[model samples]
Each structure stands twice: as C-alpha cells, then as structure tokens.
Target: MQEQKGKYEDLKHDELGIKVRSDDNPYLSADLQQKILQPRRLSSYFIVLIESGSITYHLDSQDFTLTDGHLLFAMPNQIFTPPAKTGDLKYFKLLFDENTLALLPQQFPFLVNPSNAQTLVLDNPAKERVIKVFEILNQLLISDKYETDTEIILAYLNSLLSEFNSAYFKNKGPVNILNTNLSKFTEFKLVVETSLTEQPSINAIAEKLALSTNSLYRIVKEYAGTSPKDYFINRLMAEAQRRLRYSNTSVKELAYELGFNDPDYFSRLFKKSTGKSASDFLPRQDLSGK
Candidate 1:
C-alpha cells in the first residue's frame, strides 16, 4: 500500500509562532479538525493534553493512547497522525515553533526528551496545574480584547513547560540544572540530532564533549537507557522511518543519504532495529518533492 506523501505544516492563524486550542474554542471548525486527521510532518513543536476521554495518536509509526492526565509531545519534523475522530475528547493542543521557544528565559531540557519518553503521566496536583495553565494560554490566544501581550503568554508557557519538565523527571529524581553529567548527556543528544547522517564515532563525540569514553557511556546509559552506539543507531533508524513515511525516497537513496555505504547493510540494520524491513515498515509514498 502506498501512503500519501505527508506535507509539512507550520503554525498558521497566529503571528507569534504559537497557537493554542481547546474543546471550547469556536475557531476549531469541522474542516480544521478533518485536516488534522491527515498524516503530516510538523514544522513546530506539538503538544496535546488530554483532559478527558481518550484518543490514540500516531507519531511516526508508534501509537500512543492518551487519556485523562496524559500529555503527548512531538518535536519538529516528526510525522504526526492525529486521531481520525476525537469523539468528545476534551483536550488542549499547543503548537509553537523554535522561535517561540527561544523567547523563554531558560532552556527546557525535557523538550529534548532525553529519556525517549514521548508521553508523560501527570499526578493529580500536576494535572490540575497544567490544565489551568493551558486554559490561560487558550484564553490569551483567543482574547478579543486589546492585543494579548506576548510576555504574558511566554510567562505562562514557561510555567507550563516547567510543570512538564518537573513531571517528566519526577520519577527519575530532580534534575540539577548545574549537573555536569546531565549537561553532557543533553549535549550528546544535540550532537546526534545535528550530525545524525554524519554518523560520528562515540570516541569523537566524547572528545568533543571533553569527557572520556567511559564517562560518556555511563551518562548516556543512565539517561537514555542505551549504549552510545545503540543510541546513535536508534536515532538513525528513526530518521529513516520518518523519511520513508513522509517521502518517496528509495531504500538505496535513504541508505546513502543517511551515511550508509551499503544499501544492503542498511536494510538489514533497519530490520534489526525495527523488526521489519524498510519496505514493510511503512508504505512508500512521496508527495513532497524534497
């Protein structure tokens, strides 16, 4: 089955690179809801907080069932397939670009998703707090009064993310912003994301981060639950899945594009990582020329 090539969607209907919507919002028309049901690549950060009811969201090739108190987040360039029918689900959806994130006072480490956990379960107290923040954001974005102040929005956004960050790491123990090990792990993730196709060596990454290979391995395993080499391979496979799902890139081209010298080897590795051949993993559809 050939899937339709998914288009990359940017933040629309908002000037500040941010938009918030809730069940009560009148602007969420049937047409808009239908459009979201299509599988598309997102150009901005996407988040959904389920206040009530349940919906299964498809991100890349994974299905995440989000119900009450569950928050699902996806970063830029990810293939997202919203539920075909929300069916009375009360949810707060947020879309913000990298520019909007830049305006924040502090960096949000959880946004990088070091643990590779896309959904976070919030306790009752945290859930109530998050819902209030989301309500404020929705109101501010839709206010008919004089222009809504951008600073106020950022303040609330920062608060919302703080709640998320705390809840994200709550089980793992508090993350010390000053922890050098945590910083190194975050840097490792950034390097991998930026130079994924380059496939840099673990030793090279450790040297760049001013850490010994042993120390780097410990940090990555502790945070990501994978060895450095395995983490890099997983990242590569994920990118391959994204390209394969959203474009018509052939297996050979994908292999070379992802820095694999042998397309055959790439195919085997893909199968090993995902338990399915690249062709069988997802339908090959190329709607985007790029």
Candidate 2:
C-alpha cells in the first residue's frame, strides 16, 4: 500500500508537473481503487493513448468504453480511478500544461481555447503516428534537450491533432441537412464563443453578422434545434462550469464577472441550468482577492 504525505495539489507554476508512477503506486491508491474508493483528483492535463486492450471509464455520469487506438484525456481536478483489474494495460500518457497548446501553430484556431471536452479519438494508423511523436516527446522529457524540444513535441502533437480533427470532427462524409448548414452553423458557433463575454443578444449578433434575426433563427433551428436564447444559455452554462471547476471565485463574484447584475438571479439560473446550487460548486474556503 502506498502512503502519500499530503493532498494532491496543482503544480506551483503554470508548468505541467511530470511524474511517472506505476498503477500500483500508493499515490494512485491502487488498493483504494480495488476497494472502489477513489478520492484522488488529477493535478495536471494529460492524454492517455490506449495501445492495446480495453477499459471502462466513468466520467460525469457517463461510462466510456475505450478500446485499442482510442485516446482518453484527463483535465485538472477531475477525479479518476482505474478500471477493475484489466490485464496490464500499456499506454503512453503525456502530461503537459496549457503552454503545450499555446506552443502549437496559431493558424489552427481550434487550439486557441482548448477545452477539456475536446477529447480526440484516433484510429489505428493515426494512433500509431501520434505514438511515434510521443516517442520523440518521451526522449525530450528524459534527455536534457531543453531547447527546441518543446517546439518539436508541440509540432508533432499538432500534426496528429490536425489529422484526428479532420477525420473525426471535420465534415468529409455523408452529405445531408448537416452538410448544407455546416458553414452558417460554424459561424454562429464562433460568434457565440467570441461574444459570450460581452453577453450580446440574438438580434445584436444577427445584426453584426449581417443577417436578420428571423433568418438566423431559422438556420439555427435547422442545425442546432434550439432557439437563440436557449443556445446562449447553453454557452453560458459551459462558461459557468469552467469557472466553478477551475477558479476559486465566489458565486457573487462570479455572477458579477459574468455580467449578471443580481447574484440571486444568477444563482437561480445556474441551479436551473446545472441542477446544482452555485454554493455546491464553489469551494468552501475563501479565496484570495475575493
């Protein structure tokens, strides 16, 4: 049984903390895992590339069955536990910081705001190539090849992601209602992401985009199957979860930051959207600068 001295903590700097430990290591608490008690929270951003075999993962009330050539991503503070006794699952898990994506080519706009939800699943051929890149990254991680090493790894990862995104997310397949509406829908998505901070209205966004609100609504309904207000609320929900999970800010402070005038209204809206009280998400301990 492995015994750790202190609680798991995020890295001190804005750098990824790298540590290689076996599943049996007490820090990972293999015994607790066997007993179905997993209190450990991930302290860094990482990707686990499944080389062979399969594993079941439970995340946010969903069960994901990951097989060979599949990739799993873990974001900071997310709780995880090993699957019940899978035979020697071997994979290359790369742990890095936000800087890793920042170092990627800026032309890939999707990488600009990398979200934890953006998990990439690669097929065999694609997975092999990414693993080779990781081989180079593994060398860089171990050897004192400090200069240009990060750049090299970043480029390799970008290449892998580019191909994976094209295959899995990008439209190259079936042509139908979705294909016809992809461009406009994508533009709307971009507008939502860019303007959520400003809290613009549907009519305002439609005006800015040079389209009438009714026309935009029709297109959004065709593709997204929701009204503009509902869509905006969905976007706001995502931002709220991100803040609640990552930041140590209070509910009132977060409400103000999100441009909500009434904290109580914000709390009610948040609970309606997430089915959990804002206080349940906010850390109990007071945060600095609050």
Candidate 3:
C-alpha cells in the first residue's frame, strides 16, 4: 500500500534530523507542511512547546486542544498530524530521530511509549526555561556556517531534554536515577514488541526484566500510570488500531498476527479498550500498508 508518512531522513538537511520551527523561522514550510498535516506517521520524534495558540492537534487518534504554556510530544510510527489550521499561535517545534535521541544522557520515559498525558501544562518558570533552551538550539541550527557543529548542537539538545525530563517527572514523587522507571519500562515495552506473535504473559515479561509480578506492577504503575497487564493491552490495542487504519489485514487476521488465539475474543477486547469494534472502524478507514 501507499503509506505517505514523514521520516527524519527525508526531512533533514543537516544530517542531524533536527528541525525547529516557530514564528521566526519557516513556521510551516510549504515543502513539508501539507504532507505533515495529512494523516500519517512521523519517523522522527516531535515536541511542540506552545507559547500561545488555539488549535486542535491529533496524536494517536486523540485530539488535543493546545493553548498557552502547553507542550506536546509524538513518537515515531505513531499516527499524528500537525494542527489542521494554525491560529494566532506562538510555539516552538522540535523534531529529531532515534540516533539523535541517543545523544542524550537520560532516557525520556515519555518518548518510550507514553501511557498518558502527551500534553503537559507548564508553569511560567518551566515554560520560560523550555523557551530558552529551544531558542538556543534554534539559533545554532539556523546559523549559516561552513560545518554544522553537531557536537555543540547535541550538547544543547541534551540540556533541552534534561530540562524537559525534570519537568516531566517533577510530580512523579521525586526521581532518583533519571532513567529509573524509564529504562525498565522501555525494556518491558521491548519484550512485548518482540513477543507480539508469542503472546507472552506478564509474568514472562517480568521474569525477562528480572522483576517479580508485584514489582513489575508497581514500576509500571509508577511510570506509565497503569498496571502491566493494562499497559500491555493498551499497547496491543494501539497496534490493532494502526493496522486497521494503515494496513490491509482483516480483523481476524490482525488478531492472529497479534497472537490472539481467538478472533472473537480479540474483538471483544478491542471494543472494551477502544469503545468501538474493529469492524466499526474498518469501513471508514483508508487501509493501506507498506
């Protein structure tokens, strides 16, 4: 199928996959804006820090009304579109790839399959700090130089992530290591992705991560704000949604592909999690796949 999605390699010019946009720069470049606004997945990760704006943005089939002091994040392979219309908005948008993400010292738990609250309302203090970091990187990126100082850019990028990371986890009851729950949560997520066809149980995942079921539950709850079983189910449901919208697989085939022993059971679980049967979404969706 023809999957018209945006990837960092296709979007980058400086080899960093780092693009920043605001009122100052090309707010929405003609070359990329229309494709981005279309219903497609992004290959690069994105963050939008809204200084002031009134627009509805969709991420993973959910609509978010962005306004003053709001920050939004999107991960790769996720169905996302920029605001259909840009209002009298002042915001900074940052996009980078997984390689660029490895530059940071910390693992942003939010980037690793954020369970809830993709948009955060920041206070003035946090907002100002985020704005400053964005400004610094913006200046460096758009600078006309012989060679892109990728190292320097990565340094500021790391700081930007650190600032955002601290703010992201501020209310999570005081973090010890920066990647405490984040790293384990990522490991847990990885285990599920690899075993999607195997349909591994929660205990198997916990064992792989060297944690007991209880510890796994507590950690997942603390980090993702959901139990491990619920978190896994949500992940499965999201994949099912993606397939329904973007692939040609029938619901029954999708269930089998996702390791469900029975298509009928998968259908029920889909309705419980998403409030609509797969069949309900199929007819309205534009199904295509790579």
- Among these predicted structures, which one has the highest lDDT? 1
Tens digit of per-residue lDDT, candidate 2, span 1-290: 01222322432222434432223322355565455433235555556666777777654334667777776666554545445547877566656544444445533323222222435567677777877776665655555534433444455666755665454454424533224355555567668866776789899988877778987888777656787778888778767766676567888998888878899999999999889888987764322211
Tell me each candidate's TM-score. 0.85, 0.57, 0.81
Q: In lDDT terms, how accurate is model 2?
A: 0.60
Off-target runs (Cα >4 Å) in candidate 3 are 1-13, 27-31, 113-115, 175-183, 193-198, 222-226, 261-265, 286-290
For model 1, residues 2-67, the per-residue Cα lDDT tens digits are 122232133232467888877887345787866667778888889989999999998887999999
Give the Cα lDDT of each candidate: 0.83, 0.60, 0.76
**Model 3 residue 202 lDDT?**
90
State the lDDT of candidate 3 residue by residue for 71-167, as single tens digits.
8887777787666457677888899987777655556665654445677778898899889888988988888765555667777887877777666
The TM-score between candidate 2 and the true structure equals 0.57
What order do you get sorting by TM-score, best first? 1, 3, 2
Flag clash pairs in model 3.
Answer: none
Which is the winner by lDDT between candidate 1 and candidate 2?
1
Q: What lDDT, from 0 to 1, does candidate 1 have?
A: 0.83
The TM-score between candidate 1 and the true structure equals 0.85
Report the poorest 10 consecutive residues by lDDT, candidate 3: 1-10
